[model samples]
Target: MEKLRVSDACIGCGLCVAQNEKYFEFNDEGFSKVKQEDVEENDKEELLNIVESCPAQAITIEEEK
Candidate 1:
């Protein structure tokens, strides 16, 4: 499983949560956060799509060892 990370650059645009609520949510500070980091292989494509859709480019997928 890979780890999904949201950087501090997030502008709280809510695109991530709007696209996939299962994997993302807003924190108290209103920044988009990765609710779950252990991504399954089947969901990688959708996750990548969300990453690309981020207007602030705050999302990233970290390769697992």
Candidate 2:
């Protein structure tokens, strides 16, 4: 399975959150965060696009072992 992650490098630009509220949100410090790690099959493509559009390059997709 693949998991979504928001790294510490996030700049709190709100791009990901704005693109998709289902999996992305703001943290206490105002940085971007992944609301859930598991990515649904139907949402993968949209999430991938959001990841690529992230200016901070903080969002990523990782393979789980």
Candidate 3:
């Protein structure tokens, strides 16, 4: 399985939140945070695209055994 994460490198640009509200959202500090950690198998491709498109390069996907 794959898990989603948002790093401290996030610049609070809101790009990830804007891209997918289901997976990302703004925290109290206004930085982007992972709304959900578990990534669905069917949503992998789309989520990967969103991860790559993040202007702050803060999003990451970790493969779990």
Candidate 4:
């Protein structure tokens, strides 16, 4: 499984959540948050889109062990 992480750079733009609601969500302060560490492999592309869509460059994907 892989986990999506939101860095400190997040400006709370909400773009990541907007791109893929299944994987990403917004925290109370409006920053991007990963709802799950495990996602279908086919959804990777959409996750990529979420990463790119983040205006604050706060999103990242990493393998989970």
Candidate 5:
């Protein structure tokens, strides 16, 4: 399975959320946060787009062991 993470580098630009609200959302501090849920295999492509769109390079997708 794949996991999504938002790093401390996030600048709260809200671009990720704007791209896909189903996977990303804003936290109380206004930074982007990955929704806690299993990332389906089909969602990888879209997730990658979101990851690439992050100007701060804060989003990451990793394979689980």
Candidate 6:
């Protein structure tokens, strides 16, 4: 399993959302939020693409049991 975490450093740039709306979303304040705290059995490389695209460096994906 993998978990996506958004940090307070997020400036709400929305890049993560733009990259992958299925895994990311825009809140009322327009900040990008992770749609799911965790995902199972998927392409981690694609997820990493979205996380790494975050200019704010707010998104992170960590492997979990």
lDDT of each: 0.91, 0.91, 0.91, 0.79, 0.87, 0.78
- Clashes, model 6: 0
Clashing residue pairs in candidate 1 (N, C-alpha, C atoms within 3 angstroms): none
lDDT by residue for model 4 over 1-65, one digit each (tens)?
77778888988777777767887788888777778767679998888877777777778888876
**Model 5 lDDT, residue 37, Cα:** 48
Superior by lDDT: candidate 5 or candidate 6: 5
Q: Give the range where candidate 1 is weakest over 10 consecutive residues by summed lDDT.
A: 31-40
How many clashing residue pairs appear in each of the predictions shown? 0, 0, 0, 0, 0, 0
Off by over 4 Å in 4: none
- For each candidate, what TM-score against the reference? 0.92, 0.94, 0.92, 0.82, 0.90, 0.80
CA displacement after TM-score superposition, residue 55 of candidate 2 (Å) = 0.4
The residue pairs that clash in candidate 5, if any, are: none
Return the clash pairs for model 4, or none: none
Model 2 CA lDDT for position 20: 89
Model 1 earns a TM-score of 0.92
RMSD of each: 1.0, 0.7, 1.0, 1.4, 1.1, 1.7
Segments of candidate 1 deviating more than 4 angstroms: none
Best by TM-score: 2
lDDT of model number 6: 0.78
